[model samples]
Every structure is written in C-alpha cells, then in structure tokens.
Target: MNNIILSIIFFLMLSTIVFLIKSKKNISKLFLSILIFVGVLIGAGLLYLILMIFDNDTNISDTIKTMIPLIASMVAAASVVIATYNTVNGEKSSKNKTILEFIDITRDILEKGEITEKTTEILEQINSKLKSTDFKVDVLVNNGAREFFEFLNAVEGKEKIYILDRLEKCFYYEPGSPLDDLKKELIRKLKSNNIKDMRKLWVNINQLAGTPAKNYNILYEECSYSLTNQFIEKDLVNSKFYTDSLLKNDRKIVDGLLRKHFELKYEDIPIQYYEVYRVCNNILESNYEQIGHFFRTVHRTLKTINSYYERNSLEYREHIGMLRAQIPNQVALLMFYNAVYSEKGRGMARELLASNFFGDRDDFHFENNELLRSEHFLNNGRFLNNQDAHIAYELFTYNKESNKVYNELEKMEKKVVPVDDSETKLKEEIFTHYLFNKEKILLDKFIKEFHTVPRKFDEYKIFMNPKNNKK
Candidate 1:
C-alpha cells in the first residue's frame, strides 16, 4: 500500500513536470521557489532512506522510511499544482493589462482627433508587441477602424491624406485586417467627376507625396506651343515652309509669335482638345509621381485582398466589384488615359484590365474623339499619335487573331509607305488590311456572325469595324 501510494505521487510529479515543459511557458519566480522547496524536501527524504539502508543503528522503521519519500513526493506534486495555478492567473492578469493599455492608447488617440509623432510611436510599439506574440486584439482593431472612419469623415484635404497614410500603415501591419473595406470607402469618398474636385484630389495626393504643385497656365501654354508646332510640321500644305522657317528673337516675342501662329492655323480646334491635352500633360509630366503612388497603393491593397481569397470565389468577386463600382465613369476614363499614356502606369494598367476594373460600361469616350469599347480598346482605330494605341491593343488582346494581326503588321511595315502620311494613318491602314485580307476571310466571316462569336471577338469586331463607332 505504501509503495503504491508513493508510486502514484511520483507519477503525478513526473506528469506535472512533463506538461509544464511541453507547454513552453516561462517558469515564474513563485514556481521556481516552490520547486526549490520541493527539491530540499526530496533531498532530505533520500538522505533518510540512505541512512536507514546502510546503518543498522538507525531508528527509522520501514513504514516511516516509506512515508518520508511518499510525503516528499506528495508535497512536490502539490507544489507543482499550486505553482501552475499562480502562473496561469498571472498570465491572465498580464494579458488583461496589455489589452486595457492598448484600449486606452487608442481611445486617447481618437479623442485627440489627430495622429501625432507620439501617437505613431505608440502604435508602432503596440504593433511590435502584437507581432511578437500570438496575442490578437481583433475587437480593439475593429473598433479602431470604425473610429478612424468617423474621424476621417471630419477631415479633408491634406489632413485627410495624412490620416489615410497612417491608416494604411495600420492595415498593412495587421495580418488579415479589413483593408479592402477601408480601400473601398476611400475610393467612394475620393472619386469625383467634377474637374475642380478632381484637381483638388490630385493636389492632395501631390502634397502627400511631397511633390511641388503645378502651374496650370504655364503647363497649358507649353502644351499649346508643342501641339501647334506639331500641327504646323504635319500640315499637308506649306509643310516645307513651316519646317524650314526658323525664329530667333526675344523669349516673350518668340512665344507671342508662336501663340499668334497657333491661333491663325488651328482656329477651328476646340478648347476641349487643349484642355484634355493640358490635363494629360499635367498628369503624365508634372504629377505622375504622386498619382502613381496613389494608384500603386490601391493596387497593392487589392492584390493583398486577392491573395487571401480564392480567385473564382464569390467573396473575391464581390469585394473587387464593390471597389470597381465606387469608381465613377469619368474617373475611370481618366484612370484609363493615365494608364495608357504613362509608362510608369503600364503594370497597373495591365492589372486593372485583367481585373476588369474599368467594367463593361460603354457610355464613355476619350476627349470626345475616341470611343472606348468593351472596357478595353479605342473604337475609331486612331492610334492617338503615339504608341498609346499599340500599347492598349497589346494589353487587351492575347489570342491567335491578335497574334496574326501583329504578324501582318510586321510584314506590312517592310513595305514602303508614303512619308507625308502620319503614323496614325499608316497603322489604321494596316489594321484595316489585316481585317479584310483575302487569306484571313475567316476573321471577316467571324465578324459577320457576331452573335456566334465569343465576347472578346464581338469586342474585336466592334473595335475593327468603323461603323460601330457611335454614341
């Protein structure tokens, strides 16, 4: 009976130690103290047993000898249980303290209505702590998100941009954060059709990115001068005279002469054309850094969300759809132009196209001259005077017909074309020939049977056939 009781005690002690070691918890000072006391008792019990075994003169009986070790083992087991209880309760208290501290800090920042240097520091500290442990403060994080939105609603302009930058940091650091929802809200709030509002939006973006503000009049004058010169050089009549003529005079006099010449030669050019050109130049030349940063941030956020969900899942589609819906038609048009014209925005444009960010809406046009079809191509077949059309075309097409068209264009390029003809006209002729070539009559037949064709083919037919270019 005594040996059985001792065995049970020993088993309990061994189990407690094994469990504690496997749990990988830090051994607290109280636990260490108790363990030390239990060790001393065990040492004394062993000494007594040794004395009884070796010395015949020992007064301890067999039962007493057994009881000593048994008592020691029981005491050791009890100490372990008590130590574990204290350690667990202490951890609970510490965790509760940490949570409360985070709550307090968040509340203070919210009450201040602005994020200061100190606030950023505190947030960083908290982030570091949370990252180092398995602890999660989801409730606090969600509540903070709501409070942040409320605060964001109360701010505008630079302050709004500042807060958004901070908010992005918060979401970026927190794993599985509700960043997509935050981005959606930002898109809805920032999107605008009004030019003035859009300008203000870009200005704020520029400010955030530390880019200097652009002078609209100066940029407009430069664009007008450049466009007028191009027009003069491209003139079918008197092109040689204009190309040969040179002006050397005072700076202001030269500008005045160019202005007067532009007025006389392009009197029929609408103001909207100049306005579009000015806007494009402003975006591509003066403010691309800031605008690019804004779009890249948005793209990364969306990409992060995409990584979390299955591609074909309803959740992924719905989230992407919600973001796409927030972008108004005019805003999307601007984004399309920016993506198409700016070299830095090419990857973003491709991602936007693949994700169908432009949507399937057809009631939009670029500068009232080109019709956008199927959320991708320009319908009028004009190359827009640069590689813009080619870049856009390449991005939108990924099939055999497009490949065939490319090959045909390469072959056509080897043939002599008139020097007086603009590159836009030449490319347009190439596209027309590719569509109507006798050997590729199947493409034309496919276009005739549009209803039987795939949606992309239908889009392609609409793009290639000039008859479909209408409001």
Candidate 2:
C-alpha cells in the first residue's frame, strides 16, 4: 500500500513538472505556478507525515500530531490567497492587459516622437506577444491601430488621410535609419508641414513595430492597410478607401491580401471593383498576369472582363457569396480597368494590343475591345445618350449578321424598328442612326469595333472594312 501511494505521488510530480515547463514562461505567472506547485508538495508531505505518524510507534505526542494538521491547513489556505491575489493583480496590470496598455502607449508616442525606455519594454512585450502563434498575437497591434484611427476620425476630418499619409511616410522612411536621425527627420517634417493641428500626425514606430523602419515595408503596409480598412468601415463610399492610391512600396501587402482572398475562394469575390482596381493599379505594371487573374472578379454581365484580362480557373468559379452585380456597374469598372492597364510606361507590356486605348491610332486589338461597350456608356446608366455612341457599343458586343444590320440601316427611313429589352433593340437603334447620319467618324468607329468580320460582304461593305487593317 505504501508503494502504491508513492507511485501515485511520483506520477503527480511528473505531470506538474511537465505542465510547469510548458506553461511557465512569464515571470509573474511562473511565481503563481510555483506557489501552487509548492502547496501541492507541502500538502502531500503533511499527509505522508500523518500516515507515518500513525504507522510508526513513535513515543507520545498525539497533541503534536493534532496541532500539525491544523497549522498546515492554515498555511496552505493563506498561501493560496496570497498567490491568487498577486497573480490576478499582476495579470490586470501586465501581459493579459497588453492590448489596452499598448494602445495608450502608442497614442502618447505618436503625439510626441520621444522613444523612451518604457517604449522599449513595451517593444519587448509586443515582440513576445507576436512570437505567440495564437490569435492573441495581434491583439496589441490591432487594438492600437483601431484606436489611433478612431482618434484621427474624431478630429481630423478628410485631412485625416493626409495625416495618415504623413504617418506612413514618417514610419517607413529609410530603413535602418538610426533612432536619433529618425527623430531629427520627424522634427523637420513637423516644423515644415505647417499643419496647425499636428496631433494626428504622430506615428509610434515602437508600438506599431518592435523594431526600426528601414526594413519596415511589411509593417508599414500593415499599418496603412489597418487604418484604411478602418476608414472603410467608418464610411464605405464618400470616404472611399479604394479611390485613393497607396504608397507604391505597399504593393506586397496588396498581393498578400489577394492571396488570402483567393484562399477564401468566394464565388463573387466580395471586394468592390474600385478596391481591386487600387490593387491592380499598384501591381499591373509589375505583375501583369497575377493582377490580370485578380481583375477577373467583375460581375457576370461583363464576363469578358474576366476572360480578356486573365482567363484562369479562379476567374470562372462563378460565385461571390451574397453579392449581386449588374451589367452597367461591371462595365464602368472595366472601362477604368482597361484605361489604367493600357496607359504607357508599363515596361514591355506597353506594346501588347491589350494595353493601348481604343482611340489610339496604332491600337490594333479589335477582339479585345469588348471593354469599349463600357467606355461608351457611363456606369450610372445615363451618359451614353448620343445615339452614335450606343451604336458603336452594340457593334463591338453582339456578333451578328452584318448584312442584317446593313438592311436595317437602309430601311430605317420608312418605319421605326420594333425592338425592346433585347439585342434586337440595340441593332435597330444602331442601324437607324448609322443609316441616316453616316458620318465618316461614326462609320470608321463602327467598323473598328467589328474589325474581325469578313471584309467582303456585299451590302455591309458601306465603308472601309476594319479587318483589312488588322496586323
């Protein structure tokens, strides 16, 4: 029986040691664990003493044995109360409350560019938290960013973006710039920026990151993204986050976010076109294919946006969670997409027919001009009021018998076309306008939108067929 009890005590000690080794990292928590562990050991020792006292024939002292039990109980009870109080109080002031503590520390640092020793200590704590793999790792960073953003919104108004911009600029300046130089540089900016309210201009590099800013693109990007994301949360449109450009260095953050979104594999990609466009604007010149794949996220109506920009399996998943889209909205979006992608100075991609505006004289890609349907029409469904603009858009999108369009054009003087909410309406409207107006510019624009059609059709050969100009 003694041997069995000894084995049980041995196993308990082994388990306690393992738990201690695994969990006793924080100094404050370490004391609590040790205190509890010691209590266990003491209780075990006292019980063993009592058992031995009864088992052995030691002379006298039943009174001593009785007093021993009462004393040990009192000591054990007091030890628990003391340990509990210390651990709880330490926790309230330190590690577990790091989020709240970090936020206050960050705000103060941003307001004054002073980097104090407490800042360094907080850095140590922030780094330790970051080393943790659990979600709590981001608690300090996340809360700090949100609080700073709220502070900006409450006071700075639209100028908050300008202040946020300065904060990004100050924090992400030349990497590895010594703390002293960074301080001087910030002082110069503060004096020269001439903004009366500089409260929103502070950036706490220590609280945001536990290190210097030279190799800080990723950290800087995280801060900017966090704030912009908050900016978006506060107001989706008038404070439109995507309408503005981000620092060029932050492109990797965009790519990283895109990869995460791809991992989600949502059917309709929950992001707005403007948001994706901001990403594409950042990456299109550098990573055309990836940005192209990302651009495939327009609504189903402008299916060509997906197919034309980048045709991949991801583009065709045909889902977008609970969001729905209309043809007009998606078209306007791609118009912006096409113009941005086709702008000059994009390295070798500048020569691709896909990268030139439709109006460019040297522009030669007719098949890819499906995006022109959007260029001609406004997203709000109002601006394409000119009849010729509508005709030009129809010519590019609906690949129908050219002879039928020619016949409709020729006969429009006699009767109004019986067309409705269908492709037939567009054909009649376009043909009637072209037949009567017949302006050379309109004729040329119409043929250009359909440059792939056979060049020799008898009735439709009303002007120079654009297919002959194909490269």
Candidate 2 local lDDT, 417-450, one digit each (tens): 5566668868787766754463333334333433
Q: Stretches of candidate 1 above 4 Å error?
A: 1-282, 310-312, 360-471
For model 1, state the Cα shift of residue 386 in Å: 16
**Candidate 2 C-alpha error for residue 294, in Å:** 20
Model 1, 119-218: lDDT tens digits are 3343233334323211112212222233333433444544445544544553342344454544443444443334443333322221121111122122
Best candidate according to TM-score: 1
lDDT of each: 0.40, 0.35
C-alpha TM-score for every candidate: 0.24, 0.17
Clashing pairs in 1: none
